[model samples]
Target chain A: MRSTCLLLCASSSASGGGMEALRVFAAAVIVVGFGLLATTAVFSRLQRNRFVAALIAGGLPAVATGWAIGPGGLNVVDDSTVLLLRPLLVACLGWVGVIVGMQLRASLLATVPPLLWRWALTDSVLSAAIAGTGAAAVLSWWFLPGSFGIETALVPTTLVACAAMGWSPETRSMRVVLTPSTQQMAMLIQGASGIAAAVAVAVLGVAAQLIRLQPDGTPVLDLRTAVVDLALTAATAAALGVAARHLLGLARRKRGALLVVFLGTVAAAAGIAVDLGFSPLLLPLLCGVMIANFGRERLASFELFIMRAEHVVALLLGLLAGVLLTPRIGLPGTGLVVAILAARILVKPVLARRTLGPVTHGDANRSPLRFAPLRQSQLSYVLAVSVVLAYDAPLTRTVLTAIVFAGAASDAVPLILGFRRHREVAQERRSVAGAEA
Target chain B: MGERTDMRLLVLIARSEAAFDPLVTGLLDVGISGATVVESRGLAAVLRQDLPIFAGLAAFLPQTTGSRVVISLCGADRLEALRAYVAELPPGDRPLAIALPVDSFFGLEPTS
Candidate 1:
């Protein structure tokens, strides 16, 4: 009897080891899948078709891919695995924010004409507000029957609004002849104006996240707390940026070591943020912006480091987001969300064209002005998705669904408008030929 | 095209900013992987930086100060191909391309 009991224990231990090995294999597969998914989506944007760009850019495919492999579908990436990997999600987001920070240079803002600033602000802020407020009202009303309140509605509404905002006036596909000075100047003014607006509003959203009210009044003086939060976030970013910059500079000589250091920095930032109550994105973002602006060499090094790792991280986070969205928002609810996204798409471009009208005082026939098409790329999508994951509530998930759709649609907008214009021109030319006959 | 025995450096000064892009594409066509771009001012502008007296003459010049200089190192066999590519730059005032022999390059030494 004693020998038999000892033999049973040994068999159980062997089985346990096998289970552990299986877990390791699954985790590796998921990581690799995420990396490949993200890389594919990133490369897909290089193609000319805006629809394809939008589909991939929305990260919808990645999310769906993740869901297919998650508990909701195949039970591959179980709940425990996702929960364990939360820190990784934060790090991926932080990296995306860093790329965003790099895009918005201090010099770009400094050089922007005051007149152009007026229009860009209108396109970025006002349009976002209109979309957010309208969506918030309708959705909150719809979800009010459930366990939803005004406060609950605010986050999703704000996120969707923010995601759909930012008009990019740059029509990159259109050929511009520089003979006409007025139109050339108009095109140049509208060039980065939309992107600048998007950057400003995104930073504003970060500021919004920092300020929250508690019923107990334990967190007093909202203004003071916001200031403190901003300062802390800035300090964290600066320290990490400076440190990472040094690592990157050294990395130039030792490429392998550089990859290791970059990974360490990302992990460190995410770990620290999770320990504190702060969003992991804030520090890395501020760090990226500060470094990019201050040190040219640092910017170059940072880009090289980021260029290697960003897509992988984004893919990982996007995969996690797919798993996290287990509870479905339902068919009708999703439709309403899609409608809100559509409203934002409709309103923003019209507002953008109108707002910039003051800046563009020239005849369309004489000097055809092409305003930068409202472009929503990695920044808008990444920021909104990060918020959804950070908040991780039913309402936030609903908002995430909408934001991803809108994010994808934004990429396709330029193509959609261009195709329509081409059709219209063809029709007019046919009509002219008929009249001559 | 393959591993090189001798290395040479090609320095190109493009007259137009637009010409620089076509030149780089031309280099890539002939299989040059690495190059550096340095934005530079015209000789008059450089002289103005040295002595402010030439600053007044900026109004007279066409303000063609924006220029791109591209530098790339290539294997000896590829030098003729690069020269041919540079010579094919479009009909306008194009750009100037010069080649120099490199001796004992550090990290840049070809595997062959």
Candidate 2:
């Protein structure tokens, strides 16, 4: 009788905990829905302003809203809530991966300039080296110290480096004021950004698969296991891709069925990656590449449907980042953010000019679009969020914070610098008019 | 190409598909019932599709759906009312209209 009573008591406690968790999860969904709706309404009206649109595109407002309502601020979206929403977050990560990967159509990439690839490769290498060094130094000095080995240090290092590699492709504000020659340069920069995004994620995927963090936070580099996991992920992605293609092809006539198929495919892929300890970003990415290449024109509409939700996915990831943020990035974390900001602002532009200057026949060296390298890519935020989802450690959270702060600050650099030039040009035009009068 | 008549053929090219509903409603409000609407694709879209290199220019172009072409035949008095109604429509919804004298009429219903 006593043993039976104990079992009942334990079961009741478990049930109570589950119910409490459900309540928290439901409340979080409502808050997120409200935030998304509010952001959509405001952005719809304000998107005409290029700067505002850029911010919206970067998911900054969503991030800010998330931060305001999250544990760091209101303690509403707490740790337990985020833990429960992990699957949703994983699905979003997969969505981003697929979207980025679909742009990698072989034919489209064939037309891309060779110089752009060179620039992307060179930029990724250099940024990784610089950011990786800073990450190592900071991690060694303050965060990791003696307990964890170099493998552990390398995880956040890879993250920061990848985050620093790409420049923002949103050059609308710059293009409006650019010469035709400079505008072409902007296009080249934008093309390079697209390539760099793929490179960043690819690098992140390889690094993540190779490094396994032990239960006690000790990172172990297991080459054999990594290879096996990678092979499994690729195979799984290929199978899922083929299945999704067939499903999408069948459901083409019915929009409702098509949407359900797409959602189910993403969830399955994401759930598999999460369950098997695969990089969520990589599995769906490879799947998207398959869909893009093999599915061809039949899947074009499905790809478009997926692309349409890119912004919402980005916003959702931003919200996840905000809720997961610890807001306790220590001195080392602050240093990492400042170091990243400095490197992005100071080093990235010089490197870009030196490397890509010849491609534009030195036009890039003279144009305001030259400042484009200072802005961080929107993909950088996606990269940071993926790391948070995979790890959810204090170290990963700090990296996310650093990347977010650095990216926002870097995005502002070009705009602020251009503002002075714009003002001067306007004044010159006004003076000419006055002189004529 | 024919004798002067009271009928005018109004060919309107609306800027976007979204404007079609309001455009047709306004036409009805002005007492014109019969009209033909045809889907159209803009020149830029054609150029972008035909010339892959021009796809790069898409980023700079303002996003817009291909226009709609609307053709209607009505009496001269109804044409004047149509012009006034279109003028009151929002700038974005306002269609580019070209009215020609319907030199000859075949089968049509006449509203007093």
Candidate 3:
């Protein structure tokens, strides 16, 4: 590991050495081994205790490690190398999108009751609206200044809001949800809500940004530009979906071909979105869904195959996002971070109870549905990182810092509650059973 | 050779999905590596796990994702060691484990 790091650090001896590539390849092999160990831990201990499980899935350590190596910290990985890794980061998001998209198996989703779907939709809409409004307000205040026009603040506003809207179900696998909802109804609620939350994030990613000035100081971005971005993303993804359909056979049979197809298609979809000034995260996600549903039967194997790769990419994405978190955040940046995290934390449960009040009763009324929105996962992480990478401003720093903190805390809360709730129940039972006797 | 000898099948029914991987890994570390894990939910799983908690909600459902069964066919000589190792694991967290003799076996041997 030391030798590999040294080789990686000594890159560009007058620039462009095959040895540098070789060292990176070597480093990847080591990283993959570590990723495998981490993935094994994730799966092995997944159902252990929800709190410990959360600790296992937590990105706090990865972020800390990233900080240690980051330019702001140890400087082991500097800005230029981080720049070189941008394509890989985008590819990581693409893979995350694919993992999410493949979960939209129509046959599976069809089984979820309409009542739960209504609840899920309501939960997502409420959370997004509340979080978005709060984010927009924050950016309008001390966050965005002369860099963005007051009239055009919607661009950064919606982007910040989009970061807070995603919630993860943290399924043990696609085969089962990790939540204690063993019943069909409960499982359906969990699944539908998770899917609904992801869709909400996707929609937020591509929503209107109104008018903004170009870096050249020429004014650009209008309703027309938004329309064009929407058109280009949809058209590009649709075309790629068709292209992927033909390549699916070769990809399924040949391992090398599989990697090329995914990397190529995702790269193209993401690249096209960037060129068109659209959210690059949405297109590959669409493409992934399209591919998975396009030939539904053969997709399970492909999904599982990509899952092995997904583990590695997930760690890297978390690490890179962590690396971007700097030590410096002025008072304004701190305020913006606090505004987003606090609003999300404050809004989720209150809104959940209000929306779910009509649908449930008894213990179910006291349900977990409201609690989940507080937690954020890869969907939230990828979106926040995408915005930071795209906008490149002080506001982005605030969003990233806040998200890393919020995501870890939010994910821990509900999971820890799962175990704590059980322990409390057992304690209550111990006394109550004797009292009943 | 070891291939010619009859073996015992190590059968473990773990209460939790969390225990499955560790059991497999433990066996593998002791050189009893080849194992098959299957998703199974028996009456005990429904009653003891699902019914008591999920209760009325799961009672009507056709099947729930419950209990996991892990099986590995091992050489007869290794059964005692496997049993000893499993015995060492904490009781509550451990699975319901047993070993059954394989009278006759067929098909291709697992390629390690």
lDDT of 2 by residue, A1-437 (tens): 00011101112323337666765766567556854764464644565565665576556777777787677776666555655566677777788777667767776687777777787778888887788788878888888777556567666788888888877766655543556676577777767777777788888988888877565545678999999989998899899988988887777535588778878878888778777766788888888777767755534445445655665676777776677666678788887887677667656787677766766654345555678778777677777777666666677778888888777777676777656656766787899999999
Give me the overall lDDT of model 2: 0.69
- In terms of lDDT, the poorest run of 10 residues in model 1 chain A is A1-10
CAPRI quality band, candidate 1 = incorrect
Q: Can you give the TM-score per candidate against the true fold?
A: 0.62, 0.76, 0.68
Lowest-sum lDDT 10-residue window in model 3 chain A: A1-10
Model 2: per-residue Cα lDDT over B1-112, one tens digit each: 3344887888999866556778888888888888888887555343222111101212322333546898877778887787888888867578889988766766655431
Candidate 1's C-alpha runs over 4 A off are A1-24, A34-51, A113-116, A144-154, A167-227, A246-261, A296-298, A304-314, A326-343, A355-378, A408-415, A419-437, B1-112
Q: Model 3, A93-143: lDDT tens per residue?
A: 666665555555566566656665665566556556766676666666666
Error of 2 at A416 (Å): 0.4
Instruction: Say which docking band candidate 3 falls in.
Output: incorrect
